[model samples]
Target: MTSSPLPSGHDVVVLGGGVAGCVLAARLSEDPRRSVCLVEAGPDYGPGQQGWPASLLNARALPRDDVWERHTAFYRIRARVLGGSSCVNGAWNTWGSNADHAEWTRAGGERWSAPALEPYRRRAVDRMRLRAAPDEELSAWASAALEAAGELGYPEVDMGAPGAPGRGRPLLNAVDGVRFNAALAYLDAQVRARPNLTVLSGALVDRLVVHGGRVRGVRVILDGRPSTLVADTHVLACGTYGSPAVLLRSGIGPEAHLRLNGIRCEVDLPGVGANLSDQPGVFVPRSPTPELDAALAAGEAAGNLYVSRMLVRAAGEYCPDGAWNLHLLPTAGPPLFGKLAPGRYEAGISAFLMKPVSRGHVRLRSADPCEPPVIEPAFLTDPDGRDAAVLRSGLRKAQQLADALAELAGPSDPVPAHTLSDADLRARVGTYWHPVGTCAMGPADEPGSVTDGQGAVYGVRGLRVADASVLPTVPAANTQLPVLAVAEMLADTLRA
Candidate 1:
């Protein structure tokens, strides 16, 4: 590794140009005096959506390109682009229940409260250009699903902010089938024109230079050359999987685990890679009638065929009052993974356990920064089997909705989802892609707390983590909008 000389280091160096990193770099650089640098491992398409690839810009389908690893486990799918997962996600945005905020407030303080964060949430919404799915965007199947939810007594509620559990359309960050990613939203031409803001693309962060309990600089491999970039403060916005792996590689995690990887331990933060929580669910396939298939195909030809436009937030047996634990999603479109004969479509309802108690971990395979981390989602592995039970309840609820839509689409399998054995359910489980809680926030004295309420690393000065990784608990809804709001709030804290 070669050390790069700098007469004066940057005011702040953000070590991942994902959603949060884009927000931090943009907001912090507002002051002309503060020089900020944002580093990303992937290519930056530059400026706007014009220069971006069609696959990444299309909001109708989730693109597999620009991801960290291809043909890997579904749960491990994470985007490796300048805009992070925002560049490849479903473009849906929904807020969690009040119970989620309550949990966050307990772990972090009043700042995590919904009321306290409302301004930032609104800021994120405006910046991301989030809008409700238009009526024209709804296919015949989505329209039928909405009617079915109403028949089941699920009242309509806005999915964009805090509210009671009900059925409604989620806000979308896409406009006219174009995905407006974080990079395009935050780093516009005007922002990129700022001389103080530097976006270093195709630079992989090797590790941080930690000494005397502070991060002096970060070592990165750029264009096959190792160099150190000094900064007065270092912020980790590497998302859940990448952030913890970076810390472990820098010898800032558990002593035993670091030693096992042949890396000397610096700070023994046992929680650095622990408490990995994510939402898991199962999709119950339904055979669409000829009429339904034709309608979906027509909608596709019209360029308005969205797989999932509406969802129902249903309370499970284990859910608390005024809160939901399951998301019943109705989808009808081309198969997400494989091809289907023309005019034939895949239709199903997925039951996702929103608030699961099962925990997982991310461990280092080796000291090499280029190697992928060992990620175990550990879904439905709670000792009391609560996650499995709740998921079953959700499945039963999904069956009810499907039954209501029997005229349009019928269950493919004779067996009901609720009747599936635990082993069978485990084999069929899929993720919602909302992973969090790896670098959880809490008091410095807490064993499982990697950062404090304001995102400062517990034992390391001049270092912080501001992303999905620091969220102590995964919210009950999709994580994209919440992550954007979190970055906005943390950027304010850094400014203060």
Candidate 2:
């Protein structure tokens, strides 16, 4: 691999041009004196590329779009584009609560607690437009589910207004009505126009160049051309799969696993790719109101109106470090009550069961960079059974909510005509696309940990990972905001 030297060894070379990489690069490059480079394996967005709505529907319809299509014991989807998964995912905007970070500090370390996260949260909010649902308007169908949940005695949260009847404001991470991608939000005209900042697409990074436990450069195969790029500080924002795999190819990862694959072990870090977790979620389909059915029949975006009226309700003290988010997204598809035809008009009440106690791991299948990694989610792997138990309970809660709404509106039967026994639910329960924690950040006291809270790789200078992969556990909400938050934090740390 041969190529030109960098204008000068960069201050930071961020791998992966996804949300985390983009945000970190943009923020780090804010000072004109510093240089940042973002490299992505996929093509950048263009007028020729499909729009957000089309991408969402395609993934929803084609099983291939879902990560579960891999059939590799774990379910995960990696976007091979400039914007990464955010470019093609359901453009739902949400943020993490103090409760979310507090749980991380508890499970991982105090450095990650809600208190430690306050400054990052402030910066994240400052970078975007945030709105909270009003008191009166918050009592919608989703809220009714939270109330019913409280009546059932599962933990809930009431931030302020009232205790018994839990209430929450729906926070969206949007700028105007358009979606807010880190690449878009962080890369203003100033950053985009910088000559020092090089955003390269189609640059497939094969491995990191490590010498004496420090990263010296990156190996890449760009557009079928062999090349090498050197940098002062290398950031592995390539994400969970890409980052860990790169490590393995470069003779890093678990000792035993590397030997089996005929590769020398450079870093005997067992936790290089372990403790994988994803929030369990099953679609709770809802039969549409007649008016809604008619609108959908006319080919309109059916569930959007209901989503606009959504609210999250909870009770009890916020877990701080436990499950803290309850997002109520309205999806138009087969009813949660039962399966429906393509012509059917329905909605899905998608919920993210954050604070999963379950954990899994990622391993290299072979030495080939073109081959995908072997992923074992070890879903429901926790001995406590807390994750599975909550999801089972949520399924029942969704059924109840559907029934209550059906009774009020009269839909023959609110539940799907298909009978989903407890057995079926247990068999079908899966994830809501929030996969994290393969490479976790923790204090030295924690075994098998990979990086520090600042995202710097332990024992390895000039190398860092800034993405969902660093999370020790999946949060109880969408990962978009948290990923962005960490990227921003990494930027500040790099600057300091």
Candidate with top TM-score is 1
lDDT of all the models against the reference?
0.92, 0.61
Worst 10 residues of 2 by lDDT: 158-167
Q: Tell me the alpha-carbon RMSD of every candidate.
A: 2.2, 5.4
The lDDT, on a scale of 0 to 1, for candidate 1 is: 0.92
C-alpha TM-scores of all predictions: 0.98, 0.80
For model 1, name the residue pairs that clash: none
* Residues 1-496, model 1: lDDT tens digits: 0112222378999989899999998999999999888989998998878899999999998899899999999999998988999999999999998899999998889999999889999999999999999999988888999999998999999999999888999999998999999999999999998878888888899999999888999999887888898999999999999999999999899999999999988899999999999999999999999999999988988888999899999999788889999999999999987888999999989999999999999999999989999999999999998999999999999999999999999879988888998888999999999999999998777889999889999889999999999999898899999999999999999999
Candidate 2 off by > 4 Å: 1-8, 46-74, 106-111, 130-170, 173-177, 289-292, 295-330, 333-343, 348-352, 408-423
Kindly report which residue stretches of model 1 are placed more than 4 angstroms away from their true locations once superposed. Answer: 1-8
Model 2, 126: alpha-carbon shift in Å? 3.8
